[model samples]
Target: MPKVIAQIYPSLGGTSEMSRHRPIGRDPYAFHTVMHGLRQIAQAMDELGYWGLSHVEHHFHSEGVEVSPDPGLWNLYLGQYTKRLRHGQFGYVLPARDPLRLAEEIAMIDHMLEGRLFVGVARGYQSRWVDVLGQRIGVRASSPGDRAGERRNKELFFEHFRIMKLAWEKDLLQYRSRHYEVPFPFESGIADWPAAGLTREFGVPGEVDDDGALRGVSVVPSPFQDPHPPLFQPFSQSRTTVAWAARNGLIPITTFAPIETAGWFAGLYRDEAARAGRDYALGQNMGLVRSFSIHRSRSAAQDAIERYEMLAWREWYGSFGHLGGFRFPGEEGQVPRPGEDVAARLQQVGLIIGGTVDDVKRQLDVQLSAVPFEYLVWHLPYAVMPLGETLDQLELFAHEVMPEFGMTPPEPPRLRVPESSRERPETRASEG
Candidate 1:
C-alpha cells in the first residue's frame, strides 16, 4: 500500500468573493487561525495513520494566499505537536537561500524530529520570488522566462546542493565550485598556518603537532540519520532535471498533471536509474499529489466541489494557475492559456477528487490503476470550507476511502456531545 500524506496551504482568505484580478487583502488574524488549524489537522493525522504532513514554502504574497515563507519553522512548531506523522516541505526552494545554512537547519530538524523530516528541495519557478531573493542576496534580478536567469538558477541549485551533501558526508565542509569556494583547510584535520590560525582563534578544538599541522576539527552536529535523511525533489516537465534527480537517488514528487504524464515521468526515472546502475523500483521513490474531499452524499459532495472550485478559481487558479502548464502523454505539448474553462480543465485532468465515499474510491482506483506511485499526498483543507468541515472530511476519508487502499486508519477521537444536546432515555421514550 502506498503511504498517504496531507498538505494544507495557509491561505489568508480575502477578496475571494470579489474580482479574481483584484489583489487580496491580508487578515492579521489569519496567522493564528491557520496555525491552529494546522495543529489540529496535524494532530489528527498523527492519530489517524497518515505518513506525513507536507507544506509549501512561499513568500512575498500580497494576494493573501500561501504565506508560509519558512516551512522549516512550521515543521519545527508542528513537530512539537505531532507524534509519528512525518513533516516535509513540499519543498524548500534551493535558489533562494544559502546551501550551508539550509543543510545545517535540515540536519538539526532531523535530530529534532528524530529522523522524521523528509527533505524536499526545488529550484523555484516564480520569477517574483526568485528576483526578490536574488536582489536581497546581491545577485542580479532574473525573470523566469530569461534563459540566462534560468541557467544561473539551475547552476546555483546544483552547486549548492553539492556543497550541502558534502557538509553532511564529511567531518568538515570542503567545497570549491564555480559558484562558491570554501577555504577551510582539512587534511585529516585543518591545515596549519593561515587557515589553522584563524580557525583556532574561533575556539575550534584541534591539536597542533610538532610539524604545526592541525588535526580533527569537524562540522558541528552531524545528521541523526546515517549520511543524511531521504532527499526529495518536486517533479517537473524538464526531462534533464527529472533524469538527474533519478540518477542521483532523490525522490521525485509531482502534482497537477494527468495520470499518464505522472506515469511517463515515473518511467523516465526508472530508465535513468537503470542507466546509472541503480536498481530503481517503479513506485518506491515517487509521490503524486491530488486534491481530495469526501462527504456523505453526492449532493453534499457537489456543493463542496462548487465551493472549492469558486475558492480555488478566485484565489488559487486566478493567481498561479498558469504554472500548471505541464503536458500529459498523448496530448499536444502546448501550454494551455488560462481561460473560463479553468474548472473544467482541472476536472478533466482528475486534479480534484471531491465526491461521496464510493465516488472517491472509484476515482482513486482509476487514478492508481493508470499511474501507480509509492505515495499519495492529498491536497487537503480547502480554505472555502470551515475547519470543522475539513476535519470531518478528513475523518470520513480516513475511515471510508483509506480502507479501499488497504490502509486502516485508526478511529478519530470522538467529540463529546454537549449536555444540552444529550437526550435522556425517558424523554426519548415520551417523544416516541
Candidate 2:
C-alpha cells in the first residue's frame, strides 16, 4: 500500500469574517486559530493511521495565506502532540537557508522525535522571502522561464544540498563550493582559534591542524537515524531535478503534472537510479501530490472544494502562473483565464479529486493504478475548512477510500510492562 502523508498549508485565518481583518497573518486571534487547528489535525491524523504529516515553508504572507515560516519549529511542536505520525516539511526552501544551520536543527529535531522524522527540500520559487533571506549568499529565486536565474538557483541548491549531506554523514566537513567555504578561506583556514586545541582533543579527527588553526568543522549531534532520515524533494517537474534526486536517493514528489507526465518522470527516475547503481522499479521511489475532498455526494464534495480550495487557487497560486501546470494529458493550450472556471479545469485534469467515497476511490484507482506510486501526498486546505469537516473527510478517507487501495488503520499499540516492574502473584496475595 502507498504511504499517505497529509500536507497542511497552514494558512492563517482566511474565512469570510476573518478576511475583513487586514493582514490576518499578523492577527493574534488568527494565529491562535491556526495553532489550535493544527493540533486537532495532528491528533486526527495520528489516530487515522496516516503514515506522516507535513507542512510547507513560506514567508511574508501579510495577506494571510501560506504563513508557515519555520517548518522545523512547527514540526517539533506538532511531533510533541502525536505518537506514530511522522512529521516533516513539504519542504524547506534550500537556497534561503544556511545549510549547516539547517543540518544542525534537523538533526536535533530528529532526536527529539525519536527518529519519527523525514525531510524534504525545495528550490524556492517565492521571491518575497527567498530573495531577502538568500541575499547574504547572493542567491535569487527563479521559475521555469528565466534560464539564467534558474541555472544559478539550481547550482546553489545542489551545492547546499551536498553540504547538508556531508554534515549529516561525515564526522567532519571541509567543503568548497561556489557559494560557501567551510572554515572560511579554504586555503588558509581559520588561524589562531581559541578552541582549536579543545576541538582537536574532543572533536572528530582533523578538525584542527598542527598550527592550532581550524581546518575542518564537525556538525555535532548526527541525526537519530543512521546516515540521516529519508530525504524528499517536492514539486519536481524537470528531468534534471528528477535525475539528481535519483542519484542522491531522494524521493521526488511531483505535483500538478498529469498522470502521463508523471509516469514519464517516473520512468526517467527509474532509469537514472539504475544508472546510479540503485535499481528501482517504476514509481517505486516516487510520489504524487494531489488535493482532495470527500463527502456523501459528488455535489457536496464540489461545494467543499469551492468553499475550501478555489479562493487560494484563483487568487494566490494562479497569480504566480502555477495554474498553468494544471493541464490534463493531451489537452494543450493556456490555462483558464482570469474569469474562467479554474475549479473545473482542476477537476478535468484530476488534480483535485472530489466526490463520494466510491467516487474518490475510482478517481484514485485510475491514477494510482496507472503509476504504482509508493507515496501519495494528500494536500489539505485546513485553513479554510472547518475542523469538523476536515476530521470527517480524513476519517472517511482513512476508513473507506484507503481500504480500496489495500490501506487500513493500524492496530493500537500495546503498552508492555517490564518484567522487573510486574507484581508477583505471591507478593500480591500476601499484601491482600
C-alpha lDDT score of every prediction, in listed order:
0.71, 0.85
lDDT per residue (tens digit) for residues 1-432 in model 1? 678877766665534522453444255555677678888988988887788888877787667567688999988899888777788887888777888888889989988887778888887776667677876554433345577877787787787788788878876455665566554344343344555555555534444433446554345566777778778887455578779888888888876687877778888988998898887777668888777768778777767766655565445655664535435566664445545355556666777786778888898899887777888888764454667877887788787888778864323222234354476665888999
Worst 10 residues of 2 by lDDT: 409-418
lDDT by residue for model 2 over 310-340, one digit each (tens)?
8788888889888888766677678775566
Model 1 local distance difference test score: 0.71
Candidate 1 residues lying further than 4 Å off, grouped into runs, are 14-26, 136-144, 184-217, 313-328, 333-340, 408-432
TM-score of each: 0.82, 0.92
| Pairs that clash in candidate 2 | none
**Model 2 TM-score, all chains together:** 0.92
Residue 61 of model 2 has an lDDT of 81
Number of clashes recorded per candidate: 0, 0
